[model samples]
Target: MGILKILIIVTNINTYAIGNLETGLWLSELTHLYHEAKEKGYEITIASPNGGNVPIDPESLKRFTLDEVSKQYWNDMSFRALLENSKSLNEVESESFDLVYLAGGHGTMYDFPDNETMQSIIRNQYEAGSMIGAICHGVGGLLNVKLSNGDYLIKDKKITGFNWFEESLAKRKKEVPFNLEAGLIERGSDYRKAFIPMTSNVVVDRNLITGQNPFSSKEMAKVIMRELGKLK
Candidate 1:
């Protein structure tokens, strides 16, 4: 097999409106996925709405970060360079990658929802048979993707993201752009989640993969890689 070109999407802010901020891609999500896929020799590229030095939520990194991964990640020049030179949403084409992994952060709610460029990239990647995965708020991108039949790609597919309950526990319930689980349901997603406290929970529904939080990133990637293998 050749190198697996993975496209990672981060967030960009739209407005400095009250309570809205530019949160960086979740470090745990990126580190977990990067290390696992790098071990397999996959080539990864980072992309954001504007591209260039993706911001990271320092708070999420504190709660989700590990010292080892953080150290190794910061030490890698190539990986750091990729982050610094990520393509802008408009610069990315669907056929350029074999997989697309959407990383979640508070900023995603402001940018991922209605970008025409992102939607096009998603449609092309999905139609071209690429593996698509998202974690936490990253699921925002799929809210409006249409398939070849002109149907919402995630419609009726079982998925999960950062639930409102978790948001409440974190005390940032009212700060988010929208309730992700509710929004997914509003768009006809068959969203499912485990019981209370929802730590380390993940759901894999066909080619649509999702995780409840940063803790679920690695497991989600494992599921995605497994599904990719089965695709052959």
Candidate 2:
């Protein structure tokens, strides 16, 4: 099989909508997924809606959240540089990638959903038979994506994202713009969650793949690799 290409979209907003609640890309979400896809020899492109200088949620860089993958990349100057200079989403042709992955963070809620280019990429790439993967708040990007038939991409499709409870646990319930879980259901998605909170919960609906939270990164990445391999 030929090497597949994946577009990993991160966030440019370095802070939350409210006060000083800093939020951006969750480090583990990007690191874990990137490692999994890279090991499979997939061509990866790190990009952003506005491009240049992707931010990391400060909380995610705390001692509690530091994992081997995130920790390694956090300290790697080259990796840091990648985040500093991400490609503009508009510059890339959606057809060039086999998968478009939205990496989760509170910042995504601010930009991913409303960006026409993002919706275009998600809608177009998905319609063209490419896989669409998103984790945590990154699933915010899926909220407004419409299909060619004039239906929501997630309408009646099984999906999950950063839920209200997890947001409460993260002490960010007030800062997040809206309830992601509620929004998904309102959009007619068959939303599901892990019985136990903060566990790896991933769901697949056709070419759409989503993870419930930051903890769901590793499991979801494996699922993405397996599914993409099947496509090849």
Candidate 3:
């Protein structure tokens, strides 16, 4: 196929209620996939629920979270500009991309689940046979999408996300508005996760792909590339 296009969705919320912690898109979750896709000549677009000036989780910029790719992305002026002026989700069309990726951060718990524009894009893209992938808490976006049949898109689909234990490990379990794992299960998703918390686990079920945490970002990108016929 011609140059494949990917749309990446990031959260707009800038803070978590607990500890007034700063939160936004996990930098590695976007940069790892972005750099890999760019190197392969894929076109990528960044968008947000309300658009413009996407937030980077302050914690993600810390030394602990800064991998080589993320460190490079931090200093890349052009990439920073692209993120600073992301397009609004309303401007996205399902027909415009070959894949859609939801980048994760704790802030996603507050915004991804209830945005109508995001829900529309996910539903439309899935119906159009485009691949959909999300990592960590970003999977929250898929929880609310309904297919044309009025059924939950994730129903009976084997998927994985930031597990409950991870939240507890991060010490935000009680602070988050709802339990992501519980919510996914309640919605009929056959949610599966890594036996060991924080492991890089990725699950592919048909058109949908999910990764358990930031550690899974690179591997998830490779899977997306394979699914798009970019790799063996």
Best first by TM-score, ranked: 2, 3, 1
Q: List ranges where model 1 is wrong by over 4 Å.
A: 14-16, 19-22, 75-78
Q: Candidates' TM-scores?
A: 0.90, 0.97, 0.96
The superposed Cα distance between candidate 2 and the true structure at residue 110, in angstroms, equals 0.4
Best by TM-score: 2
lDDT of 2 by residue, 57-155 (tens): 988999988888889889999989999999998888544789999999899999988898999999889999999999999999999999889999999
Better of 1 and 3 by TM-score: 3
Candidate 3 lDDT by residue in tens digits, 73-132: 899998899999998898885446788999999889999999988988899888888899
- Cα-based RMSD of the predictions, in order? 2.3, 1.0, 1.6
Candidate 1's C-alpha lDDT?
Answer: 0.77
Encode model 1's per-residue lDDT on 1-232: one tens digit a residue. 5667888898755332465553667677777777877787877777898877677676655634654675578678877777777789777763578788888877788788888888888888877777788888898888988888989988888888888888897676767768888889998988888686547777877666788887687687788777766754
List per-prediction Cα lDDT, in the order shown.
0.77, 0.91, 0.89
| Candidate 1 vs 2: which has more TM-score | 2
| Clash pairs detected, candidate 2 | none
